[model samples]
Target: MREIFIERRDRILRIAVKEKGQLYECFIEEEEERNEPLCGEIYKGRIKNIVPAISAVFVDIGHKRDAQMNMKKGRTYKQGDEVIVEVLTEQIGNKGAKVTEEYSVAGRYAVLTVNRQGLSVSRRIKDERIINNLKNELVLPNDVAVTIRTSAEDTDVLHVNKEIDSIYEKICDINEKSKYILKPQRVYGENSLLHKVLIDNINNQTSKIVVDSKDDYELIKKYIGDEDEIDVILHEDYRTMFDYYGIEREIVSLRHNTVNLKNGGQIVIDKTEALYAIDVNSSKNISHGNKFDTAKNTNMEAAYEIGKQVRLRNLSGMIIVDFIKMRDDKDKADVLNALRKAFYNDKTNTRIYPFTELDLVQISRRKKGKSIYSYIEEKCEACDGHGKRLKLSYIENLIRNEILRVEGENAINDFYIELSEHYEKSVKGDIFTFLKEIEGITKNIYLNFVPGIDSFKVEPLLFKKQVENLAKYKVNNIEFC
Candidate 1:
């Protein structure tokens, strides 16, 4: 019950993911609104900076941005040599675009990395001779960089060789036409949005590719072949594609992760700077009193969400998920095995480990760059990303302390107390009235919801500007700006 769709926007690409007719995830290829993915682009550029200390170099790839190369994460090369590197990460930050000397350009069926560097047949295809046979047929098209794409699996050798040759000839042409040894730059070949989607997502479960544009059809046909047997389906009307599939309503929900589980438990997923945390909670139907049953129920619910998230968001690297703890080791084993089996359909290679000492399950997946969330959403302005919410009991304590301090002052006018929402809820109408009875303080105090428990602010409401000026100056460390 898994499905995926590729939607081309302006020039950028967005993926539509669904499980059992429910839309689970959506991903924009990058930050740009229009115009295709940039990975596997062969660019000619001048060395911008070469720092031996960092063992990194930056190159201006003649686009609006500079291409970066790290000798550590980047391959080794001496300075001032005019060299070719593929665009690994797009430049959109204070940090330049990430580029690698060791890179591959992808196409349907296979990924072609530079030169005769041996073949790595995907684990899905175990036929070693099939790969060797393809490699033997691959003759040099005059030493231009290329890597065979995964989509090229079972592809005709003659067609693969012809397309690869066409790409290599184009790379050589760029080198010949470049204006200078150090200053001038040129770009060779890059894939369109439709082309990239097929190579990246068109695997075992891709039922069909629904393309609204005819231009995409020709490009897809060019690379993957126009045979009727291919799953690439050209759409005459996009309305039918979405209406028959409920793609529109599903995409809207994916914007905010409100993942619901079938077994009557829910998980709240919050992404933090340190790591992504998933808190499993028991919902209405899943209120099993036994610790093992409850833990297994929620963990099983969480496992389904995790599986959908792996492909939907294309999350990568180290992930530490907090699953509700269980007393029995057998219940733990059951949940762990379920999670492992859930990820079997994932396109990316995923490694899952049992719950750690912190009661957190650790997962690792390979990532190319920034996450899917970072590409689409900005951090919340109010919370400012500490993810610390408010509590009622905490507010009661702070208010009691503030009330006692106010009565002791004898002559106090107005004060501003800034705290998190949880704290404010503790000292709202009824609680505030009951607490004030103990101190009988004759002072006006205002409460400000500051989003996090660690955050604190004090203000003399009457003497606003004076306290405000000192407000920015006085902090925990007092590192005034």
Candidate 2:
């Protein structure tokens, strides 16, 4: 059975996809990660400089760094001209966002593209009648084109039409918004993460969806309206939804370097500046049969697990895998086939090459964003950059979890957490904004700033009324947070 769990926390949103209680994929988005507009976002930009040699132009989209857009052959534009552009790639390091003039809006069942002129059906949709019916039933604008997605095969025509209408209306709104704006700024953007998970994973095989936020539940309900085959559940619990469902521990397990298979096999993953390396070992999974049989069985299991780990960790770029040595070419072929089937449904563009003479397999995947480690960890100064330490945001989350645990165990809802100035500076907004959700359950939570402290300390307040009356008063040179 396939299930999706959506959890919303302070400054973060997490989505997990599981099959038979095993985590298949995880996606996390934080508020601070949105400092730049994500890929596929639309912006009305002002042309800044043109580079004729590369056929690209620089655009000012109201960001500190200017974006770059490639010009089509026969398209001409001068500086200070206004144009509509879509972000094709995110900004990396010193590079600006890569954009395109061609705009597109993707829906669950179809995608509408500008400056393209064709009605194309997905290769997966092989039914002649369905293809012909969609071609005849759908009506689009003369200038725009539409592509029928694989999910549209068994879908109702009216729903597809409704999505087209919705997309066109959105396009109209963007045009309307851009007409009056003389400056470069964002015109429209989609919450791509949630929509992507829903569109890609929640299909005919999806059995259940559990979301903690009511607003997310409503959005999902509207997206998958009247789908009686799947269950949409709203998680209402005092404990965090991820913790209640045992997904929190599973997510933490991804940080480990070794993965143990069900049959006593092991896959060890390591990364360097060059490429990610995976080693498969038979370990205790040796069978009573010959060496080839033992190696084949373990390698086959490891192949499947490696693909799952790649998606879970978002491992991209060049990757190398070393499987247990096998003599028979047929066994190697079988192991390779298993690995291919594992990544058959992966959305990212991945290319797998044949096994080399030494039996190392090479796989290349397009990079989307930073890896899971980059988001959650930082270089450890104490270890001289050889190790990684959790980021301050994650530490803040641990503090929040500790606060929740204390509130759950004790009867009092009044408490104050003391943090050093170094830790307090990491917080972006008001302390109440960070702890308000906790305060809703804990009633009143206060922050006490103490100097020279390494981390944080949480203590209960005996006199809640007295503490509130003396609001901003400093006691022994400690200020309130």
Candidate 3:
């Protein structure tokens, strides 16, 4: 099992992931910003529609993804019912949210999935006899239910009960205030980013805790003591932490498209306005062995990385994975299963379909707003609405980079650089600069600057190449490629 660590700065909490005694990945929360997530937030809401056919009611939860209630799924309610819903999945574009009436407010100790049955255990919890005794020993409220969180493995009832009571009081106050609302409004919200990080993630791996701000360190320590037995010592000097540790360098690596795998292959993710695409390739230099072995080697790494990317990127909506095809059916099954297993921790509801006739794995994750990556990079004001530049300067940059990549290579003696005039000028000058940067790297550069919706080449240069190879507007040109 993997362990998660947390570092809270300002209102953003950073979650660090590690496995087998080594740091693997991290999730950063910038809650002070407007783009912060409200998914899994619970609030009191009123029913908008009760679709008996689909068995879902459109609920008006406070922020977004107006909760969708599947009639048969959870507690039964009516058209005008005022109920509590925990956001299951976030709002994806115009689509509404998937919600459940069983609400839960989590703390450092346990999660409160309220208004239902009894305490349940995580399926991953082994030593079933011990799990059963823990369940049988715990006293559950008649009107509520809870899924004793993964962190509560050996925790005592006093601690769990205290959290349950605290949550009850807070929720009760919110409910009382919500009664005054003539219509539905978001009354309850997530805790401070630091509190949330500590509550949801325990510091299971990190050997040390360092803090720049006294308040942040105190807050984290308070949660750590309350949640588990671990003692977290705070190093007050944050400058020392950043400079002494490799955090700054590691964070820079996280922002890039390429990710290295344990076995051999690499996962290159590309995104677009319409969809997301993942390419799993065996970086041949690291390949484990023969053709079949190479394909399997790469596929396994891809499967594991695929899950991590989906979570770290918070990528939602349709996702397609182009895996290195394997001849053996068992190999294909193994890879598919690995991909699914990796995603088990993802709270979002994801659907993965089997490989298509083309040997492609199709995944659909709901995405509504700008991806996590886009938030870090400012957009070009010139693109009008998009971040990419179809103008000559931008396309010219891509051409230059491609040429520099192929320079002096025995393979690919020549390439036709087909591009529009807008892109040619915008992208070409950058090529000049790049060629200057790399000596003896020059080749023939062709330019195509035709008008009439030059969507094929220009779009790929921007959106499609991002990962999904997707275009908002379908291009009819095969000539450019």
Candidate 2 lDDT, 55-104, residue by residue in tens = 88999988888999887888878999998888877787788998887888
Ranking by lDDT, best first?
Answer: 2, 3, 1
By TM-score rank, best first, the candidates go 2, 3, 1
The weakest ten consecutive residues by lDDT in model 1 span 472-481
Q: List, residue by residue over 1-481, the lDDT tens digit for candidate 3.
A: 4444455544355555555544455555565433423555666788877777886788876555566767855457667878767666555567766777766676654566666666777665676775876666665556666667665666665666677778767767766887787776556664543455456555454344455556766766665665454545554432333322444344445457778787756888887767788888887535554788889878887898789777766777788899997989999999999999988766456788998889999887664333556434434444654754332322333343344444423344334444434443433445555334322144322334555444213111222243233222222222332
- Candidate 3 is scored at a TM of 0.65
Considering only N, C-alpha and C atoms within 3 Å, which residue pairs clash in candidate 2?
none
Candidate 1 vs 3: which has more lDDT: 3
lDDT of each: 0.58, 0.80, 0.60
Off by over 4 Å in 3: 1-25, 29-37, 46-83, 90-100, 107-110, 156-170, 180-185, 190-193, 203-206, 226-244, 260-264, 285-289, 344-354, 363-370, 385-481
| Model 3 CA lDDT for position 80 | 80
For lDDT, the strongest prediction is 2
Model 3 weakest 10-residue run by lDDT: 455-464
Q: How large an RMSD does model 3 have?
A: 12.5
